[model samples]
Structures are given as C-alpha cells and as structure tokens.
Target: MHLIIMRHGEAGWHTNDQQRELTETGRRDVADVAAHLAESPYRPRAIWCSPLLRAQQTAAIVAEVINCPIEEKSFITPDDDPGLCLDALLEQPPASPLLIVSHMPLVGALATLLVDAHRRGLPFMPGEAVVLDMPVVGPGCADMKTQFLP
Candidate 1:
C-alpha cells in the first residue's frame, strides 16, 4: 500500500489554535505539491485530514488535484499517537493509496514509525509530504518512495 503523510502548510497564530487557517503562501505551496502528486502515479485513493482548519484546507487542495474524497478525522490532531493512526489505517482495505493531512510531530512520528528501525523519528516541515510503500503497517516495514519538502 502507498501511504502518504503530510504536515499542514504554514499557518499564522490565531486566538483559537484549531481555528488557525493557512497563510497565502501555505495555500500556494500545498497546491504545488498536490499538482505534482496529480501528475505522478501515486495520487491517493482517499484522503484523511485532521479536523483542524489548516489541515482541512490543505486536504481540500490535495483532494482537488488528486480528485479524491476527503474525510475529517479528529484523532489526527498534532499530539495523537502514531500507533493509533496506524491502527486506523490498518482498518482500511489493502493495496490502496491513502493520504493523511495532519500536523507536526504526528506526521513525523507516523513516518518514522513506518521506516524507523531505531525508534528515531523523521523530521518534516510544514507542507512537507512523504510517500511510503508498505505491504503492511509495522516499524521499518516500509520504504520511502518519494518526498516533497519546502
């Protein structure tokens, strides 16, 4: 299966953390990244995004390019555990690409959990996207297929 995990684009500080929206540059950067994904062979079949405003906005952009549906998942919040996320993913059918638009530390954690044999996490910037091919969900059981960073 192809698992694509991404961090939401740059967002400005707002009074409400969950209400924070993406900046202009964030929209553009995510669009560019999504466009590239649309042109590739790895477009996701489904997209799961955090319920936060920033993540939903980012997911919308990606959904447009990938022509896929988006589902808001509250458990994808920044501090959520990578194990739970993986379990959620495991509930899906096999052999389909899934895109998860979430936040930091969670994004990095999930990515590392898939590829890290040493329990060290990978770092990803805002608007960064990593694609992994995992036959199954397990630590160090996948390969990083591609990445887009800004």
Candidate 2:
C-alpha cells in the first residue's frame, strides 16, 4: 500500500483556527504540489482530509487534480492522535494509493509512525507531502519514498 500524507497549505491568521481559509500563496503552493503530483506516477484512489476548512480545501484541489474522491475524516483533525489515525486507517484501508490532507504534526507524526514508529516524527511545513510504501498498514511496515514540499 502507498500512503501520501499532506499538510494543508498556509492559512491566514484567524481567531477560529478551524475556520481559517488558505491564503493566495497557499492556494498557489497547493496547486503547484497538485501539478507535481499530476505528472508523477501517483494516481490517488481516495483522499481523506481533516474537516477543518483549510485541509478540506487542500484536499479538494488534490482530489480534482488526481481525479479521485475526497472525504472528511474526523481522525485526521489537527489534534487527533497519530496512533488512533493509524488504527482507523488500517481498519478500512483505501485502494493501493491513499492520500491524507491534514495539519502539521499529524501528517508528520503519521508518516513517522508508518515508517519508524519508535522515532520522533519528521516535521511538515504547509503544503508539504511525504510518500510511503507500506507492506502492511502497521507500525514500521513502510518506507519513505519521497517528500514533496511547496
């Protein structure tokens, strides 16, 4: 299985973080990432996203570019636990290639958990993505294939 963990694009400062929208630069950055993925071998079967406005927007752009379906997943919210997310994902894995659009530490932690469970997770800036090739959906069962940063 292939997993692509993506951080939402840069967003404006808002009193309500969950409602914050992507900035112009954020939109462009995500679009660039989408274009990059479009040319790559990756063809997403499904995209799971945090329900937060920015993440949902980012997932929409990626899904459109990749010609895949996108859905809001509660476990991917910024504050959710990476381990919980991993468990949920494993319970019902998507197709071979699954994309998750979410926030910083979640994306980074999830990536790390998939590839190297005992180590500290890598950091992900806005509009960054990490690709992993997993033999199975379990801890330390995968390898990082690439990291695409906007």
Candidate 3:
C-alpha cells in the first residue's frame, strides 16, 4: 500500500483551531504541488482528509486537480493518535494509493510511526507531503519513497 501523507497548507489564525482556513499563499502553494502531483506517477486515487477546515480546504484543492474523491476522517485531527489512524487505514481498500490531508503533529507523528516504529513527530512544513510504501500496514513496515514540498 502507498500512503501519501500531507500536512495542510498554511492557515490564518482563528479562535478555534478547527475553524482555521487556508491563506492565499497556502492555496497557491497547494495548487502548484497538486498540479505537479497530477502529472507525476505518485498521484493519489483517493484522499482522506481531516474534518478541520484547513485540511478540508487542502484536500479540496488536491481533489480538484487530481479528480479524486475525498473522505473526511475524524481520526486524523492534530491531536488524534497515529496508532488509531494506522488501524483505520487498515480498514480501507488498498486498490490504489491514498492521500491523507491532516494537521501538523498528527501528520508528522504518523509518518514516523509508519517508517521508524516511533511516534516522534517529524518536522513538516505547510503543504509538505511524503510518500510511504508498505507491504503491510504496521509499525516500521513502510519505506519512504518520495517527498513533496509546496
């Protein structure tokens, strides 16, 4: 299975973190990255997005460019457990690569959990993405394939 883990684009400040929205620059950056991904072999067939506004917006942009379906996931929020996310991913169909658009700590932690068997959060800039290839969805079972920075 191929997991394309992505951090949401830069977001403007909001009283509620879940309500934050992407900035103009964030939109542009994500668009550029999505365009490139659409033309690359790494384009995703489906997207799993965080319910948070910023993540949803990022997923929408990628879906528009790649013409794929997006499903909102409650387990991928910033503070959600990466282990739970992994378990949820195991329940998904593995016919094609899946793109996950989520927040900082979760995205980073998930990447490390899959690739290094640790929950230590890796640093990810806004609109950044990394591809991991896993024969089985388990801790440290995946190999980093490529990275995308918007």
**TM of each candidate vs. truth:** 0.94, 0.95, 0.96
lDDT of 1 at 106: 87
Worst 10 residues of 3 by lDDT: 88-97
Measured with C-alpha atoms, the lDDT of residue 43 in candidate 2 is: 59
Q: What is the lDDT of candidate 2?
A: 0.86
Output the number of the lDDT-best candidate.
3
Q: Where does candidate 3 clash, by residue pair?
A: none
The clash count of every prediction, one per candidate, is 0, 0, 0
Tell me the whole-model lDDT of each prediction, alpha carbons only: 0.86, 0.86, 0.91
Residue 130 miss distance in model 1 (angstroms): 0.4
- lDDT comparing candidate 1 with the true structure: 0.86
lDDT, residue 56, candidate 3: 97
Quote the lDDT for 128 in model 2.
Answer: 90
* Candidate 2 residue-wise lDDT, 20-65, digit = tens: 9999999999989988877776656889899999999999988878
* Model 2 deviation from native, Cα RMSD in Å: 1.2
Q: Write the per-residue lDDT of candidate 3 for residues 1-150, one digit (tens) a residue.
A: 889999999999955886999999999999988988888788999999999999999999999999999999899999999999999878766546899999989999999999999999899999998989998999999999998998
For residue 116, give model 1's deviation from the true position in Å: 1.2
Q: Which stretches of model 1 miss by more than 4 angstroms?
A: 117-119
Q: Could you tell me the TM-score of candidate 3? A: 0.96
**Model 1, 71-95: lDDT tens per residue?**
8888889898888887777776633
